[model samples]
Target: MVSRIDYDRDMVQLHEDIQKSKETPIIRKDRIRKSNNNNTNSVHKETLEENIKNANTLHLDNDIYSVYWTDTIPDHIQESHPYIAIMTSNKPDHLDRLILNLLKNALVDPDRILVFNDGVDPVLPILEKYEMTANQLVQNSQTHTKVKGDQNQKDFYINQHYRFMFSFIFDRLHLENIIVLEDDLVLSSDSMGYFTLLSRLMKYDPSIFCVSAWNDNAYLWNSIPDEPLDHLRFSFKRQNHFGGLGFLINNRTYFNRIEPAWREEGANYKPWDTVVQNSMLPEDSCIYPSVPRSQHSPILSRNYKAITSKENEVDEWSFMQFYNPADFFVDGKYMKVYRMTMAPMLQPEYDFNLDRSIRASVEIDSLYAIGFLTTSPHSSFVFYHRVYSDKDKDWELVTKILSLVGIGNGGVVRTVYEGVIETSVLGKRLYIVGFYSKFVFEKHRATKAKMKLNDLIKLVDYGNAHFNEALTKSYLFMLENDHSLHVKVAEQSESCSTHCKTHNFSCKEPYQILLLNSGFVEYSFTSQKYCKTIKIAENSESELGNLPSLYSATQTCVLPNNPSKISCSYTPAKNENVTRKLCICNK
Candidate 1:
C-alpha cells in the first residue's frame, strides 16, 4: 500500500518536473555523474574498473552509460528469482506508483529491481527516494529531437532502448531470466509470484519463448468476477503474439536466436514487440494467463494520454473500456507453485469433432475451446456462421459473446491461443484452429465435422433457460443497434454477398428486396418487436417479385431479428414503374 503522503509528494514533484522539462532545453553534456559520498544510503560509489568487473555498464550508441546501484550486486545471484527490469520514459508519477506497488506486493529483493530510463532525468529523484537502482541511457540530443514529432523516430529510440536494456541484462548483468515491465503499468499482488512459478515451465520447455502476465481481451466486460478460482485466475494458454507487459524472458534464447536477428535499422524497422513477434519460430509460443496479473494504467501519465490521443486514428484506446483494475487477480503463491508443478501433466488433448466437443463442454462447468479453419473451402464461413451468425463479420459481436460468458480475448487476434482461435458460447468451447496446432487436430482429420447453425442453436437452447434468454437478449440487442443495416438499389449483375463484402460486412443471406411505387407509404414501428418479419428467400432479385401486389406496391421496412413478412404469391407484379431496394441486414 502506497501512503497518501508519498503519493501526494510524488505527484507534486512530477508536476514540477514536467513543467521544468517543457521550459528547459536538452543539455548536451553527459547526464551520468559520479555519485557523491554524501548520499551513502542511496548511492554506491565505484571506480570505472570496478563498474566493468561488476557488469554495471550499458554500452549504447558508442557511449558507456554507468548503471547506478543502491546496493552491490550479490556474488551468487539466485537462479530461482528473475531480475525485474522496468522501462520508463520521464513518467516519474507512473514510476513512483509502479515502484510503490512492486514494493508492497512483489516478493523480490529491491536490489534485483532495475529501472531503464530512456534519456530522462526527472525519474532520478523518485529512484533516489526509493533507493532503487537504474541505468540511464542518454542518446545524443538530436535523437531526442527526432522523437518529438516523428513516430518512426520514437519507435527507433524505443527499439534502441530495448536493445540497450537486453544487452545490459543478458550480456553485462549475466542474469539468466528477467521480468520486463513498463512504467505505465501496475502489478497485481501475485504478479512476481506468477512469473516466478511460470519461469520453471519455460526452463522445462524450450518451445515456450515467454510467459506473459497480460491477456489482451481481459476487459471488465469479458471477465467473470465470481468464476471458480482455478478456471478464473490459474488458467493458462499458449499465445500467438508476444504480450509485452510483465513478461518473463530468458537470456539463453535471447543470445542464441533473438539477438542476431534483431532489427536495428533499415526500412524493415518496426516496433520492438512486432519485430519480436515476427522473429519467433513456428514452434515458438508465449504462455499467458487467462486473467491478467499486470494491467496498463494509461491514466498515470499525461504523455501516455497525449500519445494515445494522437494515435487514436486507429482507435487504439477503444479497448480501454474493457479494462477494469479490479479484474486482475492471482489465486495465491501456494496455488501458483502447485499449478506450476502440475503444468506438464495438465496439457489438454485436442477434440476434433465440434459437436462432441461442444456436448462435452456443456457437461463441464468451465471450459475453453479453440476453433481452427479446416482444409474445406467453406470452413471459415461455416465456422463463422455457426459460432456467430453469417450476417456480419464484426469481431465485436464475438468479443461481446466472450465477455458475457467471462473470458479474455487471449491476445490481439481475440480468443486466439497458440494460433488457434478460442471462445465460449452457449456453455461450449469453440476453436478455429490455427496452423501451429495442426499436429493435434490433423491426425484426427477424419473425425472432424461441422455442426449446422440450427443444430448448434438447438443443442444449447434445449434446457438451458438462463443461457437461452441471455443469448437471445444479447443477440437481439446487437441486431437492433447494428448500424450496418442499410438499403441499396439492387444491382443487375451483383449479388448481395458481394455488395455486403464491398462494404466490409457479411451479407445476411435471403436478403429482403422491397418493390414500391412513387406513391407507396413506408411502414413505421416504435419498437423492434412490432417490426414485421418477411419471407426468407434465396439470393435472387426475382424471389421477392412473387409477393402479393398490395404488399409489393407498399414500401416495407424489416428488422434483422424478425422473419420476412412479405406474403409470397405465384403471380409476378405487372407494375414496371416500382422501385426495388434491397435491405442488407448485417450484424
Candidate 2:
C-alpha cells in the first residue's frame, strides 16, 4: 500500500501561517506545500513521484489559474458566488483539515462560509477562532430521532445535516445557489474555479439540476492512457446515483422541487443522495468532469468505512485552463461528451416455495429441475453465480480427470434421477432426467423442450408477483439442457414491477425473453426489420461490432438486489457505447 502523506503537518503549518499573518487571515498563496525532492524519507519520495506521474496530463500552467482567496467577498462574487456551507457534527480534526483545504483552494468570503453544526459544542470554539460563524442546530431529546433498531444513526444525522444546510442557505441566508460539503471533504486547488464554470453552464441550461465536483469513475478513467482530454472532458446528463463528496446545489430546483418532494416522502430514514436523485425534476441532470475536482479525505467516516481510496485523489497540479465558461465550447459548438458506464441489472427473485421432497432423487440422478434442487440451485442459475465460470473451474476439473488416462474425444458422463411431484392441477406424476456437465435432459435423449411445470397457478402467481405484473403469458424452455433456462414474457401491457422509475421507460415495447440460468448470453435475432447496429469501444472512438437495432431492457433476476441490467432496444450511434462494457443501462 502507498503511504498517504501526513496532512497533520500541513494543517499545523497552515494554522501557524494564518496566526502570524493576522492582517490577512487567509494563506493567500499555496495551502499545502509538496514534499521536498531531496527528502530522505523513501515513502514520501515514492508518493510524490506517483502523484506527479498520475497528473502528467494535468497541464496546470496552461489551463488552471493560481488560486487567490480574498479576506472578503469580491464585488463580483457577492453578485454571483455561491454560498458555501460545510456540514459538521463532532469531528474537529476533520473540520480543521477541511477548512485548511478551502483556505488554500477556494476564493471564499468568510461570511459566505457557513458551518452548520449539529449541536457539537466543541466545534463552536474552533469556528469562533477562525472568525467563521457556526450555526448550531438543536439536538434535543425530541430533535434527535430514536436511532435504535436496524436504523443507522449516521444516516439519520446525515439527512438532518442536509436539511439544516439547505434551510440555513436558502431559508436563512436567502441565497439562490449554494455549495454543500461535508466536514471530511477535501477540494482540489481548481475545484472552486471548475464549479464556477459549471454553475454558469447550469444557469443557461435548466436541464442540469446540479454540478458535482467529484466524478465517481474518475479513478478508473484517470488510469487510461491519454484520454479524458484534461479539462475538455465532461459528462452529459448523468444521474447522480451516489452523492459526490462536494456538489453545488441549485436553490430553485433543490429547494423548490427536490426538498418539497423529499419532505412529503417523510425524510426520516432515507439517504440524502437517494432523495435528491429520486426527486429530481423531469429530464434534469447533474453534470461533472471526467476527472474529479474534489474528493473525500481518508479520515474515518461516520457512515462509510472510508470515503477516500488511493484512486480518488487528483493530481496536485490538476487544474482547468479555461478563463471562462465559453472555453468549454468551440466554433459555436460544445465539445464531445464522455460518460461512466450504466449500472448493471437487478437480480431475479426465484420462486423457491416448491416442494423439496425430490431433492434426494435429483441428487442421485445428477440431474433435476434447478427450480427444485435447492442445494445445487445457484449452480444451475449461472446468472446468479456471476463469479463462477465453467471455463475456469468445471471444464478444467473435467480435463484434468480425462487427461489422467490419456482420454480421446471425451465421452459424455451422465447422471440420472427420478422424482414425483403432486400439484393442484396435475396430480401425482413421476419425472426422470439426466444431467451432463452443462445441461439437464430426459435420461437418454438429446432434445430441447419447454420446462413442464406441475402447477400452472403457482407459476403464474410467482411470475406476476415477482417478475411482471401484467405478463399475460410466460414460456420457460431448456436453452442448453436444463442448466441454461430461458423464459419468454409475452402480451405485456406494462413493464416489470422493478423497472427504474427514474428513467422514463415506456410500456409500449414488446415483452422480451431472458435466459434465466445462463451467465454467458449470446442473442439470436430472428427479426431483421431493425438492422442498423452500433458498438462501443473501451477507450477513444473505436468500433466494437454491431447487432441489430435492439431496445435496452433491464431485469432484476441477474443481480437481484443490486443495480439491475440495462437492455438496449435501439441501435446505438456510431462510436457510442453503454455506460459499461456489458450490462448496458442507457444509450
Taking the tens digit of each residue's C-alpha lDDT, what string does model 1 give over 459-574?
A: 33224343344334233322233454444433323344455566666544222311221101122121222223243233443333232122224433322111222211112223
Give per-model TM-scores.
0.51, 0.39
Query: Backbone clashes in each candidate structure, one number apiece?
Result: 17, 34
Top-scoring candidate (TM-score): 1
Candidate 1 Cα errors over 4 Å, as ranges: 1-80, 133-146, 223-226, 263-268, 301-340, 345-415, 426-428, 435-450, 454-587
Poorest 10 consecutive residues of model 1 by lDDT?
A: 364-373
Model 1 residue 396 CA deviation (Å) reads 10
Report how far off residue 275 is in candidate 2 (Å): 1.5
Tens digits of lDDT, candidate 2, 1-587: 00112323443454466457532222123222332223223442244334333432223211211222221212232323576777766667888777765664354555667776664346667667667654532233223333344546667666766766676667766777888888876665446655664565443334456777765423221222222332233322233232357888777776656778667656656766656655654334466554565666544331111122211112211111111222234456543332211100000000011111222222222112322322132211111111121112232232221111111111211110011111100011122221221122234222322333343224433232323221111222222223332222211221221132224332111112122112212221112121122332222322221211123332211211110111222122333222111221111
Candidate 2 — what's its lDDT?
0.36
